[model samples]
Each structure stands twice: as structure tokens, then as C-alpha cells.
Target: MTLRSKPYHWLYAFVLIALSAFSVQSVAETSMEQTGELQLWHKISLIFDGPETSERADYNPFIHYRLNIIFTHPATGDRFVIPGYFAADGNAANTGAESGNKWVAHFSPNHTGLWKWQASFRKNRFVAVSAKVDAGVSGGFMDGQQGQFTVSESNKELPDFRAAGRLQYVNEPYLKFAQSQTYFIKAGPDAPENFLAYQDFDGTFHNDGHKDDLVKTWEPHLTDWKKGDPTWQNGKGKAIIGALNYLNSKGLNAVSFLTMNIMGDDQNVFPYVDYNTYDRMDVSKLAQWEIVFEHAQSLGLFLHFKTQEAENQGLLDGGGTGLQRKLYYRELMARFGHHLALNWNLGEENGEWFKNHPTMPQHTNERIAMARYFYENDPYHHHLVIHNGIDYDDLFSADSHYTGASVQTHKADFSSVHTAVKRLRDWPVINGRPWAIAVDEPGDAQHSLVPDRMNPAHNNARQNGLWGALMAGGWGTEWYFGYANEHSDLTAQDYRSRDLFWDQARHSIAFFDALDVPFQRAKSHDELLSSAADYVLAVPGEFYIVYLKDASHQPTLNFKNFSGDFEINWFNPREGGEMQQGSKTTIQAKWVHKAKLNNTFNLGLPPSTPNQDWVVVVKRK
Candidate 1:
């Protein structure tokens, strides 16, 4: 029953037709420019035609050649220096070429008008740092090139990364999209670790013994494959691309997948030429992956790039500062860093938990070094976060490159999500920088978030998984399907498994957006309520949201030293209903229920739905 052994290979032709319908727009143009005319925020690639060199297996081209491009925005005089990478033939996605003289530089313009670029190709014995050396003597044909192009104003509509401009981490507790002033909140899947195990792309996992049965056709998402969307080589990625569509349609905005999972769980996804190989990249395969990522951006989906899984921590560079790991990271940034909205996760549960593992858990300094590399290299400076295992508490540091915490827990009821988020949110402030925290992985390992078929109500998941994180001022939660469940994390092929839960997630987002809740400025205080079942995220008198976790009885809120007339609204968290009117209550010194007092009030709220989770929102009148 493993994916690779599945006989869905016939669907390859079907996917090709689906992908080709949209890829006709991206089909290769006969020109030196790898990218054609692009809108603002769209990536434009400049390809330097040159002589093909040794294969990735034969020699490390990453160390021998360096391509640096500086693009200057004419209007503001803002300079952007971005690194370039080797693209084999520039059509490697379809051609699968391992050798070619196609060196490419990709740029996403911030503004429209004439932009100038200059390329400097240098041959270096040590690629990590550039020193004064022979420049022109060993350079190839594309060296010392210059060009200019006009960036037209983008015409793309909402939900696209183009509309959002760019997502940046500005040393804040949350990530904000550039120019939009909108804080991001994500809700999506954190399962099917082998998300890229599609049939069309170039990968060795299909023949590899570990996950030969792990092939996924993504058949359920086929209908979401819209025409005119980008795809590669004879419809290779229709189902997977459609998966993004299905998520977007359901109102989920973020998805996580492993870029390289060699020697780890599933062993079906990676960027290299084969499962066992590390240094050599499969150029064509990477190109195909870019196509999928591009479509996701267009759909307003956030890309979560998990670089390494725990099992393979010591596989490359021996989990130390080494050249092999540096090259892998460099290639990833060059090829995918141009993306507008993405977060680079250093590893999945990254630490040594087993006594027999080759590498010990990464030391604090090693983790800091990794973060510093991304901070220095990426021009856009997208959000950076690290997933946790047992060493979760050790990752909090004010000086680190991490912008947030990608939290994970083994509590199926998600009772710890709120407390975990609150702790990280408060702990980082001591270092003078607050970290944006997201419970990316939650629920117990064995029976995490099961599908709607088995648990249509999704009571505990809805009560704690969705609302718990949101009320705690945590950005979002991505449901992790448990391994012991039917559609577990590593084996899920259909997303409908959690259909009902997705609806609840959408409801949560809508609630915040509709009310324009200023969650960014609020703090979580569970002590505000007398009952332990109630939780509050409030700016005190200005606005207060009290979540009734138990939904059993009417709770009295202690708004100590609060005196004001307020409007109260009740919301049913479980049923996804509209706000219902609650008693018009005024707070004073020692008001009892609705009676006004001198300077305090213990406001009593009636149940919106008996025995169901509810949210009580109070705003000053």
C-alpha cells in the first residue's frame, strides 16, 4: 500500500494535459532572458548563455563559479544585490538536463519603470567569501553583463502575492505584508510530510525502498486544477497544484512541506538528484517545484519550506558548519527566495532525541549560525522560524534570526496551546524583541486530528486546537494528522479528511476580520475571569474578548476598577453562527452582575449556547 507501488502512473498523462493547459503560457521563449515581460512584484530572470560545465556529481559547480547581480531601482536609487544560480539549460524542468551553460539571476521588482542590472561572474576557489583575485581570466561568456528593463504596474487582483507586495519580518511579534499593513494569520494542513511525492516530477523516491508505496496522486484535488494555471512537463503537477487551490477555496492560507527529507520520515521529498545523493541537485525537478510554489503565491497561500527533517540532521555536513550544507542552503535561497511570502523552517523537530543518532542535538551557537546565514543572504528577508522537539524551550533568544516560534505539542486536546503560545510571546520580550508564535503542529502523536468521517463534531479539536491558539494571541494553527489515525500525517492523500474542521478555521478568521480585532496590541489574561474555563485577550476597557471554554455555566468577569457602559455580543464557536445580543452591561467599582457600582464590576454573562464553546465580546459604548 505504499505510494510508489500504487498503479496511478496512468494519471501522469492526465496530469500532463491539465498542467500543459496552463503551462502553455510559461512555455520557453526563444531569448536569453529566462523570464519574459513581468508585472510589478513578478520575478524576472536573466539568463547568461555560456559553456556547459561538469555535472554536479563530477564536480561542485557551486564552489567554482559565483554569479552576483545588482539591480538598481531608478526612481528611489534603492540598490538590491541578489545572488544568482546555475540553471541547466533554463528548461531543465522539461529537459532534465544536468549540464548546460545557463546561469540565471532572478529579480522581483518593487516598483515600476526602468530598472538597471549588472552581473559579475567570478571564479573562486572558496565560494563562501570573495577575495581579490583574477576576475576576467577564468570567467565565462556571461561575465560582466549589463541590462535594463521596464517593470509594468501589476494587474493581478487580490489574494495574490503580487497584490500583497512582499511579506517581511520587521522585528515584530507577527509578520506583516509590505505596503498592505495587514498582519498574517495562517490556518492549514501540517501533514502528509511527502507533499511533493507526485508522479510527474523527477525524483528517486518512487524506486527507493523506504517509501516506494508512498506515492500520492492527489486525486481529490483534481477539480481544483484551474485552467491557465502554471504547470510543468506534460501535466506533471496538476493534482498537487490543485491541492493549493482546494485549501484556498476552503479559506486556509498556509501550507507546510519538506524541501528535503532524505534519510528521514517518508524519504520521498528532496531537492537533490537522488534519494542517496546530497551535493548534486536535480535541476529539472527544482524547476517543477518552483512552478507549484508560484501558483501557491498567486492563491495567497504562505509557503512553509521545511529544509531538513530530524532523522537526517547529521546526513549533510555532519550537523556541523560544513560546505555541503552551505551549498544546499545557498541553492535554495537563490532559486526560491524571490518568492514574496514564505518562511524557511530550519528543521522538523530538529534535535537528537535518540541515543543512537549520529548527531547530538544542535548546540545553541550552531542554530544561531544557521539563522544568521539566512538573515544575511536573503535579500527580501522573509520570516524565519524553527520547529521544535524536546529542546523547544532552548530556542528562545533575543539575538537569534528567528522571527517566531513554530510550535509543536503532543497534547491531543490542545490544552497546552494557549499556555505555550503565551509563554513564548512573553519570554521573547525579555530579549527586547517579541517573537511571533504559531502552533504549526499540535495534538498527540497517535490520534491527532482525525477526519470528519470519524469525528464529525471535532469537539476537542475545535474547542482547543482552533480557538485556543487564537485567543492566546498566537497567529494560527495548522492541524497535524496523527500517525495512528486513518488519514495520518505521513499518509494523508485527501484533504477532505478534515472538511468540518476547515470550516471552523474559516469561521475564526472571519470573526477577526469582520470585527477588525486589534489582536496585535492585545495580551492574553486568563485570570480576568473567575471561572477557569474562560480566557480573555483584551485591551481592557477599549475591547475585551472572553472565550468560554467549558460552556457549562454563566461566568462572571472581573473587570476590576473598570467603570463604563459597554455593549456585549455573544458568538457560538462550535456552530459558526452570527453574533447574538447579550445583556447590556455597565462596569463600575463593585457592580454585581448588571448593577452599576462605584469603581469595579463583576459582569455576568448568560450562555449563548448551553454546553457549547462561546466567545463574549465586550466593547465600550
Candidate 2:
């Protein structure tokens, strides 16, 4: 009667036993339900009926049972083994149920064709936390069930992730969409790290008495919510959902939020049902989070899941990859990893730091282990990065598992942004793999990015933080509000407080989009400029972008290594508009040495805005 002796017979007997275990009425109930638009890059959910379990059960449904769905594209033989989760009653957000027989898995098919799937449900003492695929004995109901579905082409257009496909790390300095092959450059918020500490979520954090004052209502953004938007529990999520709408309206493509912060700065955010309960998860709270996340994807916003902060890095498994860490990561991947664009940020300021108390630091081995777990477990294999408290020198080597770096620079004027970005871009060359660098935190902690009423111009932010990162071949930036500023990182409810600054960020993104140049292939060549203060990013003889931080510093390009007939155009970074003709419309390049004659081509002045920063775009015509 062993499973291996006669596999098909054993499966049949298992099914019969499972059917007898439940009443005839329960056995007649549908075992599985499929939902969502069955199209390419759209989420397709498979909800199955399993053993009825509770979040507070002695068997711990979160860690004692395992569900993995093996999905295969018949055409290309591309298979994705996606993880599944326990969904209480299959409608926990609306019903607020604590126990049920529902288990679910989500899949976003990358190709448009027939796809086959099979469920593998297993049970053991602690099988959910194990990385092994076949870690436990079979649990019968839908264990051997097989099915097929068809995915058609998506009709979604711009600003919808379905139109662009998944944003993947393709061994470049930037992430590119799989469908469009368009390189991505993000601009968004990096502050309010406790974004999930909302009042509507189902958790005990509001009354936990640990930084309960930091919980947010997100009241100001309720007006931004439009008709046909998604909400839950008699319209409980409008304010938070509207905040995402405002960010998209501002042309921001990315957002950063923390999932767990038990002992961190704002302790009101965590995924557990209770503060001290780590093994059990609040099913309804997580379901509400999925609603917000799904809306963000539809709006084309990248999710930055900062798993922990430095203060709580050691709260689970003492900063090692153990049982607690595995279960936490498993729940996240199962529930939200189906989104198109996201990066699993290991931790914010991951290393040791001291403000009022000292935090535990994860050594190089521990850090790599944590990253390796996600790299191997996540079915999508989305971009992986780690924020720095000190630096990323240890991860610059060839064995590193991270695809990018979430940088934090400490400069009030953001003067160090360029150097930090350039260093990350250059150091990884020896390993033959470049890390996509993003300046997530630009300025100092006390006065990073102030409100528009405080500094409407945002001169330093535009000149140094925005343009500086772009000119140095950095992918993008996310602004972090200083703690001392109004609407600071932890307590901010309104996004319009930095209204003027969002315009500046939008202008920068617009300039890049309008040019339509292959900037992803371009590299930083600051040494080619006459003034070291200015910056030059070029694809050698193809296209060039020269950023002049000060309009007073008239610089020239060293055309000694390049030769072509080039057209020069001027652009205003502060106020985005059409490209204007500069003082010099054209220049003929010829090879000449610096030691010999004036081999440099004078870029000349901008057509207008002579006192502010300007970007000069030169292209071979």
C-alpha cells in the first residue's frame, strides 16, 4: 500500500479516504475556484479547499501545511513553481473570518497560450518552512488534481503593468520590462517607512502601546480616490488607496514600505495577528494589504518591500536565516509576489547603527544567506537589493546574490549623491556584473526634503539629488523626508506637502521620456568634460547628455576620441518642455589630443534660463 508501489492506486485510495472524512454535503462542495481575467500578465488565482484550520490552531496552519502549484507553459516548457497560502474562508477581507478550508495560489502568466497546472498539498510537523519541494506526506483533497487554462493577450495600455510585462533584472545597470524591453528609471517616495501602519488594518499594533502614536489614518488622500477604485469592508481602504492614486498622478513609478518593524522605529507595523505572535498571521489584514498592492500594480507603481530595519534585523533568528525568517519570507512570496514590478529589500540600513540604543549587525555571511533564501524561494525571481547603513563593499564581489543596491547618502545639499552612485557603478566592473544603483535616501536625516511651503524652489534637490544620480548612470531616486521637517517620514499623512518637489521629479522623468535615446547603454564619462564639476553621460559617438549644474560653468566636450556631425539641443530640468536650440546648433567633431591643440568642442550656453541648471543633449546627425 506504499505510495511508490502503485502511485495511481494510492492516489485513488487517498481521494476516497478524504471524501469519507467529510460529510456528503461537504464532499459535494467545489474543491477549487478560479478567478480573475485569464490574460497575459494578469493575476489568475486558484483557491482550493483544504483541511479546515484556524490562525490560532495548535498545528499552526501557517507553518505546518504546504501548498505548491506547478504551472507549465506547454509551448516553451517554461514552468513556475509558485507558493500558496492559507486564505480563511476565501473572502477574509470582507467577512473577517479566522478559520476556514480555503487555500490559494496566484499566477501571472508571461505568455499567451494554454497552461497546465497541478497542486501538491503536503502536511508535516513544520513542512511550510522547509525549502525542499517534497518535504512532507500528501494531504489528499486537491493534492493530485490537474487542470488547464488559456491566457490571452492583454489589452492594457500605458501606466498599467500588464502592458509592460514584468520588470526584470537582466544583468544591466537598470531593470527592463520583459514585454516592451524598455529600461526603467524610477522616481518616488522613500520616507514614511511605516506606510503599512494604517488604522484600517486588522492587527493589535494600535493598542500595543509601542509607538502607537505613529499609526496613520491617511485622511488627507480620501479625496483622491476616484470612482471604480477597489476597497474593502464597507469602504475601509479609500484613504490609503487614494494615496497611491496621488503618487501615480504625480508620475511616480515606485513606492517603499516596511512589512515588519517589531523593534524598529515605528513599531506599529507587522503582519502577525498579535505583536508577540510570530507564527500566526492575521488573514484579513494581509488580504486588505493585497488590495492596496494590486491597485498599485494596475497604476504601474513598483513595490519596495523593506522587510525590516536595522533595529529589528536580529529580532527573528538573531539575524540568521532560520525557521522564523523562512516562514515570514514564505508568507510574503505566496501572498504578494505575483505583482509585476517589485524588489525584495532585505532590510533598511541593514548593518549596525546607534541612535538611542545599539542595533545588531548582520555579518557578511548572514547577509548573503538572507538574500540567497529569497533568490531561491521567490518563483518570480524579482529584483533583490539591500540598503546600506555603512557601505556595500562586501557585496561588490562576484559571489553576491543581490541584483542592486538601495543607497542612502548623508549630505544635506545632496552633494555626495553623484560620487556614491559613480562608485557603485565602477566598483562592480571588476566582478563583471553591474549593480543597479538607486539613491533611495538622498539627504541628511534632519533636513532631507522639506515641504513646498518651506522651500518651493527645491534648487539643491533638483541640481544635486535628481540630476546628479541621473548623470552618474544611476537608475533613479526616491526622496526621504527628514524627521525634523513637517510631514516627516513616520507621521506624514498628506503627500501634497511636497507638491512642488513632485513636479520637479516629474519634469526629470519627462525629459528622459521625450528624448527617446538609448540611455541604458550610455556610461558616465565625467573626465571628458572640461570642468570636473559638470557631468557627461555618453554612448561614445551615438548620443551624449551633458549636465551643467551651474549655468555659469561653460564646459566643453573632449571630442578627441569621437568624430561625427552632431546636433546640440538644450533642455530645462527645472521646468520640463520641448527641446530648445542652444547657442551652438551644430559641431563637427575631429580627433585631436589634449596635449596638442584645442581638441574639445565648446558646448556653449543654454538658449534660456542662463542662471539655472541646464541639460545639453548632443546627437550625431
Candidate 3:
């Protein structure tokens, strides 16, 4: 038995490690020196203040930030060459009223070590330039006194984490893919502010004090809690976190919490926030909310909520005038403060309309607002994502910064792995951020309500997340009780999706964690793959995964390079076990893509007969 056979439990161990040596230049090869300026251009243009998620009293206000600059050399610490603040003058004068902050900066960092700057700013008229700006470009802080970030968004009253007179941005830069103790989001030039973080701007908190277990905030109304009517148990926040922590202990990184997920919108003639009614929202259940967050925090799991990424506009259903919807979004952002969870997906699969016209005025307006809301508010909370079809590029701006997008590529059933992975990688490189995929495996084959498809999608999604640019976390497949009749008896098996989800995620978590660190950082070597198509590779450093679906017709494996000694192990995702390793010397000259959505791998033409269903894991010298 191989280590991949038995599933491992995550205990949720985490340690905060500041980045000491990062080759930012090594990534993307897109040099900022070419794009950004260093002369003290116009600096007085925008303001970055308040808690992250702030909404204007009526209209969300635009922050005017101006940076006056000057830079000295590194080694000699010599004469001033580059003028400061990117010379913040002579830029565009007019910004659309509906649009927000228009600002820029003149800053330069020469090396990969800690870089610090003393930045001070003045807000609109009222306050003098009194804000502190001991900002550091590297992982360190303005100085030794302020490198760490303290969050108090959950509480009504601020905790005494900082000194009384200390006023700082409650922003945690989500400048990386993986979630950690503080912050979410990987910094890029996608969203305005060109970043994603959490906040309500003026430091808003709805919970009176805070439940001891608030893992992360959710709209207290998400669960089905009536007015003191306890039918379904309140979601045990702590238990959920504890369960997740256990998963993390075993190697799981994080979870995609269905915080505001509601029932089907497919059936509704007019869309509504599908789950329990809003009037039935119970504030007392807020206690339960804390417990959930506490558990998540304990287990080193970061929360990626499902909804409230934008306003619950009831049902736009075409009746929503563009102005009406956009206006509602602006206001909703002000109210919800454009925040919640790591990935604030606006909605689930609403169908062709949502996907087709992604940047339609209403959608773009809402999307832009949401992006800014999170960026201007809470960036770490802005690991933005949108769940739906394959063409993720269309879902987001060719340059818009959305929550990291993902696809529900139901493996075997809906699509193939290779196809799904292609879409995931290309989405961000050509567009913004990156996309994620899920291995959509079906446990209840006989009882599948929708189209009973499965594999290349599932396996590919997992591989892409583990090895692709869009850092895939665990599986995001559907899980729940199948549709039922009036007199249905609920059994544990009834929720086959749940069981399958837990099982698949548990196993796949092991597979993903086994591969690489900074998985998203791996460059695309798709060019060095099989030209014929039946097989594709998700290659990391010293490791490569060849997803073969040659079940129907025998495939001829032709590759560019497969030299020297290597160990090949097959992993049977179907049987939930591992296969023995095999030695390979003769490289087949013909292997074309053959697997379909149902994952029919027909590998029985010449060399060997079929054994167990397994994914080949290779360790090459």
C-alpha cells in the first residue's frame, strides 16, 4: 500500500513566515520599472484611509492620494536621482462621478530585501496631513514597531491591540494566493487601487461585541433561522472550524465556505435570495457565527464566502433597469461595505445571461463596484471569485480584478481534465488574477439528479489547482442531499454529494499538498506537452502530471523529453487507493487525448492490460 491510499486528516498547524527572499522579477517577467514612474509626479490625488470596507453616506467617496517623493541610491546612499511621487501632476482632471478614487504614486525598490518609506497624507480639506505612512514594500513594516496587522472588524468596539493614539490602515494585503493568519489576495494591476483587501472604510462593525467563535463574518441571515424557531440546528461555527482545522492538519489549506449560498435559482421565474427569507434573519444566531470563525481560525483555514460579494438585489430578472441595478450595487456596497470572505463571488451559476454579458453595464457596474469595494475596503477579503462556466475569461474583465474565479468542471460527467485546465490557466494570463477548478466526481451515480457525467474535469481541475497558475485549493464539487419527495426519509447516505465531497477533498488534499509550494508560481510549460491532445501535463519543478484518457482507442505516446531514470506511481481516484509503482523505459511514440467527460481511459492496445484506475505520479531525475 502506498501513502496515497489511506486518507489523512488535517490538524490545522500554521506558522507565520515573512518572505525574506522573493524573486518578484522572476515572476511574469513584467517589469514594473518599465510601467511605473519614479519622479515625484502629482502625488496629491487619492486618499487611502478608514477601515477597508467603507461606503459613502450616500455615494461612495473617491480617495485622493498624492505621494511626494525622493529616492537615494542603495550602496553609496548617494545623490537624489529620481524625483518623488511619480510627479503626481498633469494627469486626467475629470473622473466619472460614479467612479471612485483616482490616484498614483512614484516609488521604486531596487532589491528584494526590506524597503521602507515614510508616507504622510492629507485627506479632503478637513484633516491635515497627519496619517502615518511607515509603509514597507517588502514583508516588513514601516519600522520594527509596525510590521504586523491587527484586525478588529468583527467587534463593535475596537480591541486594545494597538496604542490609543496609533491610527493605521486596518488593511491586510491579500498579496499572495494561499490564506494565512493575516491577509488574502495576490497583488496585481487588475482591480482599481490595483489590489484587494477587506474593509468598510470608516471601520464598520455590525456585531454588538462579537461571538467568541466568529471565524469570519457572514450575513447572519445566511442560515435558515426563523424567529426563535429552531428546526435545523444553527450551523455550529466552532464545529465547522474544528472540522476544517482537522482537515488542515492533514495538509488541507483552506475552505470555500458557502456562507451566503442559497437554494436553486434555476426553478425561479424571478430570482430571489433563494434560501430562508431575510425577515427571518436571527441576530442571536450571531453567536453561532463566531463559533464557526473561531474554529476556522484555530485550524489555519481561511474563509472564502459564497455570496454577499455584492448586494442581494432580490431579483433583477431583466426588470432591473441598468441604472437601477448599478445604483443598487453602489448602495449595497455602501451597506455591506463591499466585503465578506476571501473570495467574494457575486453569484453562483445564474445561466447563459450572466456569462454572456459579463461586462454589461449593470454587471460591469456591479463588478467594478464590488472590486473597488473590496479593494478599497478589505483586500485580503478580496480574493474575489465568480463560479460558473468554462470561459472564465469572459466572466472577468480582460483586465478586471475579480475574486479569483473557478469552474465547476464536473469531471467524467461534464468535461475533460485537459480542457478545464487550459481554460483555468489562460483566463488570468490573458485576463486578470487566475481561475480555479474542482474535480466534480459523483458518488451517487444511480441517483444523479442532473446529467450523470464525471472525470477529466475533476482530475484536471485538481491538477490545475495544485499545479496550475490559479492556485486550486481543495475540490469545489457539489455536495448535498439529492432532491426528495414529500415522504422522503433522510439518511446519511441521502447526502451522497456531502460524503463524496468530504471523501474527494480529503484524498485530493493529500495529492495537492504533496506537489509544490507556491503552486501558482509555477510557469506554464504546456507548450512542452503532447501536441496530439489525449494527454496534458501540469508540470511543476522536478514533477509533472500526465492526465491520460486513452481508454477508447489506444493512444500513441509521443513526448518531447522523457530521459533518464524515473519512478511512476498510479493513483486510482475511483477506488480511493494507491497502486504499486512501475518502471518505464520504452517511451511510446503515440499518445493522443482520448478521455471524455465520463473519463473513459482505454489503455488496452499493446504494451499492458488495464489494471486499477490510477493517475500516474512521476518523480524524475
TM-score per prediction, in order, is: 0.88, 0.94, 0.45
Error (Å) of candidate 3 at residue 413 is 2.0
Instruction: Give per-residue CA lDDT, model 1, range 1-621, as digits (tens).
Output: 554575885586678677765343322321356575577888888887654764463446666677778889879997887888878887888787888878888888888898998776666555523423344233435555677888888877778878878887766776787756788878888888788877778867678786777778888888889998767777778889889999999888888888887777787888887777766778888888888888889898888888887787777777764677777888888889889888999877877665766454665766777787788777787788888865556656655777777889878787788888878777746365577888888888888789898889887887777788888888888888988878788888889889888988888876776675667788887787777766888887677888886646766666666656777777877666677765545443334566665343344554444566778787777
Mark the regions of model 2 whose C-alpha exceeds 4 Å error after superposition: 1-30, 353-359, 429-432, 592-595
Q: lDDT tens digits, residues 1-621, model 2?
A: 576677598778888787766544443453899999999999999999989999999998999899999999989999999999999999999888899999999999999999999988888988998877778876666776789999999999989999999999888898999988888888999878999999988778888898989999999999999999998988888999999999999988888899998888899888899888888899999999999999999998999999998888888888888888899999999999999999999988887655643445787887888888998889899999999886788776656789889999999999999998988888745355578889999999998988999999998998889989999999899999999978999988898999889988988888877776899888898988888888888888888899997765677888766777999999988888889997789989877656466557888889877767899998999
Best by lDDT, which number?
2
What's the ranking of the predictions by lDDT, best on top? 2, 1, 3
Model 1 poorest ten-residue lDDT run: 22-31
Best by TM-score: 2
> How close to the true structure is residue 245 of candidate 3, measured as C-alpha lDDT?
37
lDDT of 3 by residue, 1-621 (tens): 554553541211111121322222222231122122121111111112111211122222222221222333344453221111111111211110212222222222222233233323223321111123432122111111111111221111111111111111121112332212222221110101000111110111222222212223222222322233211133322222333334444433344433332222111111111132321112213223333443343343444444421223323423233433333322222222212223455544423443334222235444445455444433123345565532344555554556444444333233343355455655433343344433222222222222113321344323332222222222233322222321011111112222233344455445443443233333334444332433334444344444443322433332333333344555444433444444343222222355222212222322233432234544444
Choose 2 or 3, whichever is better by lDDT.
2
Better of 2 and 3 by TM-score: 2
